[model samples]
Target: MRRCNQCIVERMDSPVPLIPQLAAHLVAAGGKRLRPLLTLAAAKLCGYPGTAEGGTRHVALAACVEFIHTATLLHDDVVDESQLRRGLASANAVFGNKASVLVGDFLFARAFQLMTADGSLRVLEILSRASATIAEGEVLQMATQNDLGTSVERYLEVIHGKTAALFEAACRVGAVVAERPQLEEDALAAYGTNLGMAFQLVDDALDYAADQAELGKTVGDDFREGKITLPVLTAYAAGKEEERLFWRRVIEENRQDENDLEQALDLIGSTGAIAATLDQASAYADRAARALAVFPDSPLRRLLADVASYTVSRGR
Candidate 1:
């Protein structure tokens, strides 16, 4: 998956040379490739008929998913004004926002080109819908920023659209390419969705609880950005009167101070928000593993299950 990503970025040509450089920056700063791995695992578990011809299509389609994901990261960094991604300077921070946005558009076009080459209308449709959903989720999150009333339910909905939709679509495309039965397709899709949700839950917990260096970004970043996540939601729900007032000032009044961050962290710790969020993440991981029970046992299936477990176990 990583090599395919590198190759695509290397093959890219842009009228603006900076765009290719931005694309290379985005691609080279590696992530787990969890989405593509899910695609491959789904294909294997579905008993894809072994054929040399199918392998190429599978790989191309997987690369297409990663491209779409990378494009989103480029745009997200621009929107979030993020300085760091994958422990390196974000494309927007390094190459400037215009270059990042334009390069992201190039990646989107390249992903479409790859999809067309695969000749799977189903794959195309799933990815297109997922893209739309992801956009809507971003807008929803933007709308809700710093709003103390943002419920846990709403937060879950946002992550489902912003994060899990792509994961689900990736698995769905894998099944489509493999010509899997409907039941198997549904199972893989469910597994991906649950896994993605768990991944995000852990991320939210880490935003408040992790060391700055270990997280590859500043701690309390979400709070500073006024993006309320799971731990904050839990703390808000369970906080004392004074703690609620603290939230009102930091989140509502935009009064973030060092003391405010410490207070928020204290509230999160005292209220058991971090532990609660971890429990939720573990539940989602369990659901993800359970979704694969219908498939015949194999190393690929076991690896998929392990990946789900690892999502929650990851050190931020």
Candidate 2:
């Protein structure tokens, strides 16, 4: 993690001083760095041999993944008009939206630079496509937001593009760098994709279920934004006519009052939406664990499986 941090600092250096400064501020704000960790772990699992110079290309690539993820966060905060991230004021909130957006672009360019430095078209292709897919997902989400007519399949597609695509790329790149067998590479990709899905599912559920402190931002942030997550979809599906009217007014029409969020919570709870969401998350987590079955028993495998389990457990 420290190596990744230093890599970010080194890469952020630019003639435009504010570019680096703004990028550095959010990078310094702590996160679990789970995506990079997965990259490193996948490389290790594949028994990647360092180059003659005693260098692990995986570390640089892992740092690149972090840069991409952080870049998304910076842009996401601006788009969401989010005030807090990782329990601290968001980059857009503290540094202004313009600066945050520019720095985010800078970080994205830096990520591509790292990908090119690695000198693998495969790595470049995966990361580049993931970046594009993430943007598409964001746009798709905006299109679907507050539209109660959104189907479960469409919601899954959004999460797969926005969240799981990067995870799949991150893990797949590790296997590519290590020149792992195709079966093992596919397994790791499956593991990452499922894990990412579980992680996002829990995150969506937490927006309604968790307190502000535990949630890292305000509770009901999604409700306030009129974002339609799975729990909202589930409850809306199960609602009676009066309850459906309430949802249409609040979510579709965006006619929320002060008491609307409380009422939303009550409806969600009554419909068992939180539990249902978590159950879906758990199913994904299990699939992630099963994806590891291709690998032999090892500490890395155990740790990765535990991470999958921890994804849903965090919601609880």
Candidate 3:
């Protein structure tokens, strides 16, 4: 963890003062550090010798993964026009979009530098592919926005690319650095992918169910942005003709009135879309746990399993 922090600090030290400040602010809005933890835990679970210096490469790689993720968040806030993130004002909201975007680019370049310093072509390949996939996912989601025809299949593809790909790469890269067997590396990669998918599904569910304070953003944000997520998609699919018409008007026609929020919530509830979304998330969680069955049992493995369990139980 200290190594990861050092790497972050080193990357943040920049000739451009504004870049460092913005990067610091974004980094201070800390998350679960689940990506780095996944890397460290994967190394341990793969039976890497527990020497004081054994996992330094994994730690560095983990930090690199987090840097890439945080950089994307800064840019995403700008693109999404989001005000709040992690319970505080987003970098773009505070520093303006231009600064945010440039700083995000700085971080991306720094992450690349870190990866190159590691000198592992495998790590570079995984991260480069994940970055491309994330960009593609963002574009796909943009294309599908406000379109009621955004099917479950399309939604899954978007989330897998946008959210799960990085998580998958993190775990796989850790295994690669630890010199794990090919089969074990594949299993960990699958575990990360499914876990990431489940994690995003739960986030979509909470967007409807959680309070503004708890969610750290406005409820119905996706809907207000004309973005159709799982709950709305499922509800729209199962709703009555009049209910479908309501969704079409709000989502497709972009005709939301003040009363539309309650109407949308009621319709989603009526169609049990939230429950169905929960079921889907739960299934992905189960699949993530199943992916770990090939690995030998250890504390790290147990923690990974617990993380899978917590994905469904988390508030946001």
Candidate 4:
């Protein structure tokens, strides 16, 4: 990870002042680096040498994963008009939307450079496809925003594209770099897909249930944006007629106010939406753990399994 972080910075270096400056703003904010970490772990689990000397390809590819993820964050904030990222002002909020979007492009370019430098056709295919799918997922989400009629299956499709697709690629790349068999690659990809799904489900639930400090953004940003997530979907499904009206007003109509967030929280809690979402996330986490059973029972395997559980239990 240390080398991976260095690679991330090294790739971002440009004489252009604002380019590096805007890029560093979000990257320096210190996210979990979870996607890159997944890459490193998957590589090790697949019997690749450590990220030192003989295993440096994984480092570059891991950094490439982070670049892709960071690019998505930059683009996502602009699309969502989000003000906060990791509890700090978002790049779009601080650097303006144009700069943010262009910088996001810069990061995407850097990711491609890393992928090409590695010179693996399969790795290039996996990551590039995931990049396109991420954009599609976000667009899919845009289509579903504020529409209560969006089905659970559609919601899964969105997350699978937007969130889990990269996770799957990150893990698959680990095996690819290690030159693991197709069986090992598939196992790790399955682990990553389930973990990413659980991760996003928990994030959506936390938007209603967690404090600002814990959440790293406004508690009701999704609701304020009229973005329909699993929690709102659950509440909207189970709510009474009047409660449904409130959801329609705040979510569908986009007529939210200060107190509306509090009310939304109450409705979500009353309907057990948060709990239900967490339960669903837990189910995915269990699937993620089971996906790793094909690997030998080692410390890395156990830690990765624990990470799956931790993804759902994040707020508390």
Candidate 5:
């Protein structure tokens, strides 16, 4: 992880002014770095420590994973028009949207540079496909914005592309580097895909109910942005006709009054939307845990399973 962090910092440095600074503004703020961690752990599980003894491929790949993730975050904040990220001014907010987007593009280019250096066409294919899918996911989300009629299946499709695709690639690449069998690679990808789903669902639930301190961003940012998430969908689906109208007003028409957030919260809470969303997240979390069953019962496998279980707790 330390090596991956250092690699991220080093690779992000550039002679071009403003790029590194803008990238640092977001990266330095710090995030869980969970995607890169998954790469390392998956490699270890497949019998690669990514250290001096085994090999150093995992470290660079992990950094590449992180770079891909950070690039997405930079783009996401601009698309969402988010002011805060990790409880600090977002890159788009601190710099400008144009700078943030360009810096994000630079990071993506750096990621591909790392991939090309690795000389693995397979790894290149996985990461490149994930990057493209992420863009499609973001565009799909935009298409669904303020769409109260968006189904849960459609929501899952968006998250699978935007959030889960990188995770799946991160883990699958681990096996690829380790020369693990195809089944193991498939299992690791499944673990990542389900885990990513759980993580995003919990995040959606948290957006409606968590403290700004814990959430690291505004609690009602999703609501204010008219982003269609499962919680709002659950509430809107179960709401009375008048309540549905309220969803249409705030979510579809983007006509949120000062008290509307509170009202939305009440409806979400009263309709058990948060709990329902958490339960759905729990289901995915369990799937993530089950996906690791193919792996031998080692500490890494156990730890990864624990991570799947932990995603459920994060929502609570």
Candidate 6:
């Protein structure tokens, strides 16, 4: 990631000096770095050779994946009007929305530059398509915001596009760069896709589950933004007449006020929405684990499965 930032700064000569600063701010702020790890793990699992004397191609590609993920986060914070990220003031909050958005674009450009440097059409194709799909997912989520009629399937589609596509691409690139067989490539892709789905599901649930200090953002941030996540969908579906009215007022009408979030949480808990969402997440996690059955038993394979398990439990 240090090298990734160096690459980013070396490429930036825009009129606004803070463009690099704003882009680098969140990157400097640490994250779990799971996507890049997945990429590296996939490469290593597929037998990509790396020695102390010689460099590995996977490092650059892994950095590229991080750049893509960071770009989305910058854009997402602006769109959601978020104030906190990773337990710190968000890029938008610190740099202003305009700066954040522009810097995010800069990051996207940098990511593509890295992709092109790798000199693989397959790598470029996978990452580029993932980028486009992520944008589409965000737009779809925006369109469905606050709509009570948004189907569960539609919600799944949104997460798959917004979150899972990159994971799928990340692992796919690992296989491509490693010259792994197509079957192994497909297996890693399946693992990534399912893991990404489960990751997002738990994230959505955690919006209501954790406090600002714990979650790195304000609790009920999704509620304030009027985004329709699975937990809200489940609760609203199972709610009684009064609970339904509450959802309509708070979500559909965007008429939220003090104590409304608490009421919303109470209703969600009473309806077992959180548990049900976690159950759905667990199903995806199971699929992620099952997808790994094709790979020979190794620490990496076990680690990937452990990641799936950890994701479902993270919100708790």
TM per prediction: 0.95, 0.97, 0.96, 0.98, 0.98, 0.95
TM-score of 6: 0.95
- Lowest summed-lDDT stretch of 10 residues in model 3? 47-56
TM-score, candidate 5, is 0.98
User: What would the per-residue lDDT of candidate 5 be over residues 1-316, giving only the tens digit for each residue?
Assistant: 9988889889999999798788677677899989999999999999975477859898999999988898898889998899989999888888989998898899899999999999999999999999999999999999999998899999999989889899899999999999999999999999999999999999999999899989998789999999999999999999999999999999999998999999999999999999999998899889988998998898889999999898879878
Per-candidate Cα lDDT values, in order, are: 0.83, 0.90, 0.86, 0.92, 0.91, 0.88
lDDT per residue (tens digit) for residues 1-316 in model 3: 7777777788789887898888778778877788887887787788665448565787778888888888888888888899988888889899999999988888888889989999989889999899889889888989999999988999999999889999899899878987878999999999999999998888888887788877877688888888868999999989889888999999999999999988888888888888888888888889989899998777777889889989888733
What ranges in model 3 sit over 4 Å off? 49-51
lDDT of 1 at 154: 96
| TM-score of model number 4 | 0.98
Q: Find the candidate with the highest lDDT and give its number.
A: 4
lDDT tens per residue, model 6, 1-316 = 4544455446544667797677567757768888988887888888886534364678788888888988899999999999989988899999899888888888788789889999999999999999999999999999999999999999999999999999999988888988988999999999999999999999999998877787888788999989999999999999888889999998899999999999989888888888999999999999999998988999988998999999999876
lDDT accuracy of residue 41 in candidate 1: 64
What root-mean-square deviation over C-alphas does model 3 reach?
1.4
lDDT of 5 at 30: 90
Pull out the clashing pairs in model 3: none
Model 1 stretches astray by more than 4 angstroms:
10-15, 49-54
User: How many clashing residue pairs appear in each of the predictions shown?
Assistant: 0, 0, 0, 0, 0, 0
| Clash list (residue pairs), candidate 5 | none
Q: Which regions of candidate 6 deviate over 4 angstroms? A: 1-16, 51-55
- Candidate 2 has which clashing residue pairs, if any? none
lDDT at position 232, candidate 1: 87
Per-residue lDDT of candidate 1, residues 49-120 (tens digit) = 444544666667777788788888888888888888888888888889898888888888988988888787
